[model samples]
Structure formats: structure tokens, C-alpha cells
Target: MMAAIATLLATTTALLFGAIGSRGGKEPTRNPEELVTVPAAPSKPIRTSTVRSQPSAPIPLANLPTSREPTSPQLALIPKPNAERESLLERRKQAGDTGILPGVGIPGGIPGAISEPSAANALVSSLGAGVRKAAAGQPDKAYALEQKDTLMAQGTSIRCALQTRIITDHPGFASCVVTEPVYSFTGKHLLLPKGTKVMGQYDAEPDSGRIGVIWERAITPNGVNIDMESPGVDNLGSAGHPGHYSAHWGSRISAALWISIFSDAFKYAGAKYGPTQTSTSSGIVTQDPFESNTAETIQNIAKQAVRRAANRPATVTINQGTIVSIFVAKDVDFSQTIKAH
Candidate 1:
């Protein structure tokens, strides 16, 4: 009983050891090999349709015209009639019955009016005769006589003929009296001293005797005395007699040369005096004889007067003196002493 029990115990122990060994072999001690991975080729890149924006159109200019430009219109050139034509027309109108009209058969008459020659023709003839007489006689006297006759026939006085004279004893200064013929009650006459630079005027009728106004006297720096006279007349018709007219007219005569000298002197005086003021009753300024402070007033006044005289275009005269009348104050009293020269 005891041996059988031992054998059974041994067999049990061996069966248990075999079962433990089978379990250890199935679990192994070392780790498994790592897996190697190969990367796939990159897929072809996807293509996108590119849409580029087109550039915008340019703008147009404002001033430029799309069509043809319009053209400009043309102007006309035409002339009008002059004053001579108008005068001829006026003469034609007055030819028939107007007694005041220029005499039809007179030397200056219209063409075909009478057997007598035209005034223009007669003037030419007289001029020719004067030339011949000057050639044949004492040239100076004959020429002077011819000029005197020409003045008388023209109903105009020579500058020398209108002299009312003033004499100056001064060494550097001189002057002469002047006179004008009165034509009508309302007519205004201009008078300039003998040897005064003056412009001339024309009259339909001849000038007459002079009437007295006032006298002026002045002394020069060199101790010379100057005397002057102003004259008036009732009517030029009263002076029709040649001797009577010439007697008074002779007093007003001045040398043309002297007159020119005096004009220059006057200009100098004006410049020295500065601009003179002329005012009316209302105190309104009328003439400014002076230019600006820098410019000369006297010269300006003289220039203005000359311009006015020349602008008349119909006549030739020294109009500068007229500016004095315009610029001088009407109400102001001038010293006779100052005016005399």
C-alpha cells in the first residue's frame, strides 16, 4: 500500500513540470523585427484655369472736335465821302439864290459860273505875277508887296499886320503890344503881342480897327521897360477903309522872329512857376498847368495847347495860348504889371 502511493505521487509531479515548460516556449524572450514603410509617388499637381483681366479703354479730350471745325466769317472794306466832297455839295445847293453865298463870278467861284477866271486860277496868276515882279524889281520890296496884296485879297491879316507894339528897354527881355479886330457883338477875338509867337486864323470878312482895353507895363531884370496895350472894336465892317484899318492894325504888328523867342521865354517861366491852379466860382479845379511832381506842368500845358491847335486839321495856328484862357481862373484878378509884357 505504501509503494503504490509513492509511484502515483511521482507520476503526478512529472505531469505538472511538463505542462509549465510548454507554456514558457510559446511566449519567446526576444522582440519582433520593425516593419519598413515605402512612400508612394506624389500625385500630379492639379491645374487651375487662369483668367487675366484686360486693360481698361482710354478717355477722350474735351477741346478737340470729332468732326471738322467751323470756319470764321470775312469782313468787308469800304470807304466813305470826305469833307471836301460835302463842301462841294453844299456850294451846289447854295448856288441859285443865296446872296450871302460866296460870289459866283468871284475869283474863288465855282467852275463855268462867269467869264471871269476861277478864284484858284486867279490865285495862281497872282502868285506868278508876284514871282515875275520879284525877279524884275528890288526882290525884297516886291516880295513884301506881293505878300501884302495876297493877305488883303484872302481877307486875312498877316501876323505882323496885327501888331499893337510894346517896346522893352531891358537888356535880356523884350515885348510888343498885340490887337484883334472885333467882328460882331458876340464874337470872341484873340490878341497876341507884336513879336509874339502866334498861330493864325481866317475870317470871311476882313479885320477892322482896334478898340482899347487896358495897358500893361513890366520891367526886366536887365533894367528894360515893356509896355503893352489891349484893344477892342465895335465892328469889323467899320474898319473897311484900308488906311484906317492899317493904321490901327499896324500898331499890333510884331516880328515873327521875336514872337518865337517870347514863346520860349514863356515856356521857361511856366516851368519855373510850377503848375498853376485855375478854379471856378464853385472851387472846382479846371486846369492843372503842371504835370506830376516829377513832370513839368508848363510844358504839359503848352503841349496840350499845341495838340488842340494841330487837331483842328482844317487850319494852322499856335493854339498853345488858348490853353491859358482855359486854365486861368476866371474870377482871379491878374496884376496889370505882370500882364504888360
Candidate 2:
């Protein structure tokens, strides 16, 4: 009986513990709002771009940096109305002239000369006067042209005779004696005596057998020096002293004959000979290139020598006492010298 009572109490203790465990496991579910607390709407997003401006302070007028004065001169000028411009225009209209230039009138002075003295005109005048004064004349000495007073006018032909031999190969001085007296334009007064001495330089290069020299000066018999840059001419109105011409044809002819023979020989050797084969026909049938070229060169040289010999300049031999005329290229002033006679 005691064992059955103990069993009943054990069963009662088990049922009470089971009931407490089931009630603790069944927890009540809560709302999402209560579980995850909604974040406070973000305080209006903090602005990144807006700049907070500081108040501008007033600056004193005198303390402000000022611009420096201009280094270049003031070129832009204000235009002003000219009262005389209209009057000048009216005057020009009344005169029946329509010119853009303000002062356009016939000058009182010589034609092609300006009479008015404007700024530009005065400057030009001063510049011209300055150029004429010291530039033309040396500082230490002054030079001027005296009256020429030529006895004979231009284009006068004076008869003169050569006193010295002249060879055209070399340049040299020559002298002449006047054969006839020179007279004034009217032929009333004698200008130069018959014995007047004339001198010149024969410095011209040989142009074949021809020669013409300039007579540089003339000396009167009375010992007064005169300038006569005249030309020596023949009586036939041709220039230069008429004299003997020695051709020396014998030497030229000998040289030309020898040159011709040598040239012919060279030309014969250089002539293109087509292949001529012998009975022993080796395929190599050729002329020596060096020999052919040398022959051609020699032929050309000989031809040139022959040409030179034919065109040789003849020797001009102007002997003493040959007659020549002095062409007065310009006025020959012998008045100063003739007055002494």
C-alpha cells in the first residue's frame, strides 16, 4: 500500500513541471516599428556648395592702387572746328578751283618753285641748303669753276703731227706738235700758235689694228697750260693716228700649215673603224678607248690652235712724224694762254 501512494505523488510532480516549461516557450510577437526604431528623418542634408560670404569693408579712395602715367606721348588729339576752313573753302569755290589741298595757288616766284614757307617747305629748304654747303665743298678748301673762255668752239678740228713712235702692244705717253694755228670762232683772232705742244696717253687695249687715244692736255708756245681732253683722229674724220700695219704673214702661215697637218692626222686616227677581222678571228675585235679619246682631244686642240693663228691681231706701228688730227671733243679753253701772246 505505501509503494502505490509514493507512485501517485511522483506522477503529480512531473505534470506540474511540464505545464510551466510550455508557457515560457510560447513568447508573444512584437510590431516591426517597435523592433527596428525608424531613423529620425536626416536633418535637411548639410549643404556642401553654399559659401558663407564675409561682408566687404569700404576702402579709402586715396589708398587704392592707381595706374602709372603713360610712357608714350599722347598721340590721340581731340578734333576742333576750324573757322577759317569754311572761309578758305568758300574762297576756293569763288576762284573756280576744287582742290583738296588747303593752299593751292600759283606761286609768285619762278615756275616749278614754291614761294610759301610752310613747316614742310621750310624743313626741305633747310635740308637742301645744308646738303649743298659742306658736303659738296671740302671743309679745308673751297673749289669753284672759273670761266673756261675757249677760243675754238666745240667740234673744232685741229691739225697736229705725232712726235713719238707708238706701239699698240704696250701703254705709253705720246706727244704731238700743232702743224697749223688755231683761230677763234670768227677766224679773226689767232688762238694757238703753230708750235703749240700737245700731250696724251696711249692706254687703250688693242682692238685688232685700230687705236684711238685721248689727248689730255695742251701747252701753248707762250708757256700757259691749258686743259684739252680731246681725241686723236685721222684727217679722214676717223679716230687715231694713221700709220703702217705689219701683219707678219709668213710666221702665221707656217704655224697654220703645221696645225692643219696635225689636226688631219688626229682626225684620221679618231674616226670610228667598224670591226675588221683577220683569218685568226678571235671574238675580241675592239679599238683602244684611251687611244681614241686622246686622238679626239688632240684633234680639237689642233683645230683651236689653227683658229687662233688665223685670227691673230696685226701689229700697229705708228712711227714718228705721222699725221693725226685732234678732235676737240669739248671746248678747249686757250683764252688765258692766248692773252699772254
Q: Pick the candidate with the highest TM-score.
A: 2
Writing each residue's lDDT as its tens digit, candidate 2 over 188-299 gives 6777779999999876446656567789888877786778898888888787766666676887778767766776676565554523333433775554322455555666
Q: In model 1, which range of ten residues has the least summed lDDT?
A: 323-332
Clashes of 2: 0
Give the per-residue Cα lDDT of candidate 1 at 289. 64
10 residues in a row with least lDDT, candidate 2: 72-81
Tens-digit lDDT string for candidate 1 (1-341): 99999999999999999999889789667888899999999999999999999999988768865764334332111112464466556656654333223435466444323334456756766776777677788744333322221111212232222322211111122122223321211122222223332222222222333222222342233333433222221234222212222222222233333444556677666666867777676766686564343234444555555554443222112111221100111111223433453
**Steric collisions counted per model:** 24, 0
Q: Give the C-alpha lDDT of model 2.
A: 0.69
What lDDT does the true structure give each of the candidates? 0.37, 0.69
Off by over 4 Å in 2: 1-150, 203-209, 246-250, 259-311, 338-341
What TM-score quantifies how close candidate 1 is to the native fold? 0.13
